[model samples]
Target: MTRSARRTRRTRRMLSVAGLGTAALLTLSACGSSDSDSDSGNDSGSASSSASADQKLTGKVTVFAAASLKESFTTLGKEFEKAHPGTEVTFNFGGSDSLAAGITGGAPADVFAAASPKTMKTVTDAGDASGDPVTFVRNQLEIATLPGNPDKVASLKDLTTNSDLKVVLCDKTVPCGGAAQKALDAGKLKLTPVSYEQDVKSALTKVELKEADAAVVYKTDVKAAGDKVEGVDFPESADAINDYPIALLKDAPNTAAAKAFIDLVRSDDGQKVLTAAGFRKP
Candidate 1:
C-alpha cells in the first residue's frame, strides 16, 4: 500500500471512532434527561400529596365541658389527636352553668358540652351556640357517701331528717344541684347541706376526701369516684334525669376541629366510651 493511502485509512478509522463517541455521549445525555424528568415528576407528585394533606383540619381546639364529662371527653380528645395529626384538644371542665355563663359572657371556646339542656339553653338563648344543641347522654342523681356508707343513710328521707349526718350538695345553679332539688321536691323532702358545692365533682370530692358524710351527685360522678365513694340509689332520683347537650360555639376559633370533635362524640365509638363511663343513652 502507498504511505498516503495508509494515512487516509487511519484518518477514516479515527473519524469513525469520534462519530461513535459522539453518538454514545448523545445517548447518555438522553438517558440522563429522561431520568431527570422522571425524578421531577415524582417530586411534583409528592408535593401535591403533601399539600392536600396539609389542607385538612389542623390547629388547637378548645372545649368547655361539664365536670362529669372529664374522663370520657379526655379520652375522646386523645383519640381525636391521634386520628388527626397536628391537631390539639384543650378542655376546660367545670360546672355546666359556669361554663355556659363563660360562653355567654364571650369566652373564647370552640365547643361546649353541658350536663343539662337548661344550661345549654343558656348558651343557645344568648346566641353563643352556632346551632341547636343536641342531647347526647342522660344522667341520674345518686347519693354519694364515704366508702362503706358508715352513716347508715339509705334514702332521701334519711338525708332530710338526720341532722347528725354531714351532707354536702351542689349549688342550685348547676345541673346536678337542680336535679337534686327536683328529686328532693319529688320526695317532699328538704335537707340543709353543710356546704353547697359549685359542681357535682366538687360535691363528690368532698365525699371522697371525707369532708362530708354524703353528697347528692350524679350516678356517673359516683362511678367515676370508684372506691373513693359509695353510691346509694333512691327512688326519688327517678324524678330528675339530666340530659347532657353539646354544641359548637358561635365564635369558634377552630370550627373545623370543633365540628370534628363533636362528630366523634356522637359517633358509635364515643357512645361506647360514654356508656362505659356510666352515662345513659339519650
Candidate 2:
C-alpha cells in the first residue's frame, strides 16, 4: 500500500474508536441519570410515608380526672384506644382538689379533668394547663338514701331533723361537698354528718355500704350506684350545680395524643356518654 493510503486508514480507525468511546460515555451518563431519578422517586415516597406515620398518634397518655368521671371517662378512654390503635390511656381518678394538688405539685399527667372550675383553676394558675379549661358537663346534688325509705327521709329538712339516722357528707374541699354546703345554706339547714368524706363517691359509698342512712352526692353517682342506693331530688339542690372542666397539660408527654383525647371528650359521642350517666351537658 502507498504511505498516504496507510496513514488515512489509521486515521479512519482512530476516529471510529473515538466515536465508540463517546457513545459508551453517553450511555453510562444516561444510565446514571435514570438511576438517580429512580432513587429520588423512591426517596420521595419514603419521606411521604414517614410523614404520615409521624402524624399518627402513638405512645401513652396519662389523665388525671375526677372520681365522678371514672365510669364515663373509662369508657371514653377505651374508645380512644380503639380509635388510635397504638395509643394507650392510663387514668388517675380521684377527688378534684386532690388531683389539682397533684398537677400543681408537678404530677406527670397529660390531661386534667376536674369536677369544678375552682379545682381546674389550681392547675391553670400554676401554668400547667396548655389552654383555657373548657367546661364539659354539669352535675347537681342529690340525697342518696337506702334502697327503701326505711327512715322516712324525704327531703333535706328530713336529713337535718333525723337524729337517729346516720348521715354522710362530702368534705367542703371537694366540688360535691362545696355544692352540698351551698344547698344546705340555701335551705338555711344545718346537720352534722356522721363522717365527712373526701369525695362524692366516698360519701355515696358510705350509704351504699349501709355505713350511713343517707348522703349528699351527685345525681350521677346515685344513678351509677344502681340498686345499691336510692336518689332523692330536693328543691334545695337546685341552688348549687357543679361545672366540670377539662384541659390538656402544658408539659404533656404526648401532645398529639393528649389533644386527640381531649377532642374525644368534647365530642358529641362524649357528651352522649356523659348524659347517659346522668350528667348534664355544659
lDDT of 1 by residue, 1-282 (tens): 999999999999999999999999999999999988887857675775466446687999999999999999999999999989989999999999999999989899999999998899999999889988999999998999889998888998999888898999999999999999999999998989999999888899888898899999988889989899999999999999999999999999999889889988998999999999999999
TM-score per model over all chains:
0.80, 0.81
Worst 10 residues of 2 by lDDT: 45-54
- Where is the poorest 10-residue window by lDDT in model 1? 45-54
User: Which residue runs of candidate 2 sit more than 4 Å off their true CA positions?
Assistant: 1-54
lDDT of 1 at 84: 92
lDDT of each structure?
Answer: 0.92, 0.92
Give the residue spans of candidate 1 off by over 4 A: 1-55
In candidate 1, the residue pairs with backbone N, CA or C atoms under 3 Å apart (3 or more residues apart, or in different chains) clash, namely none
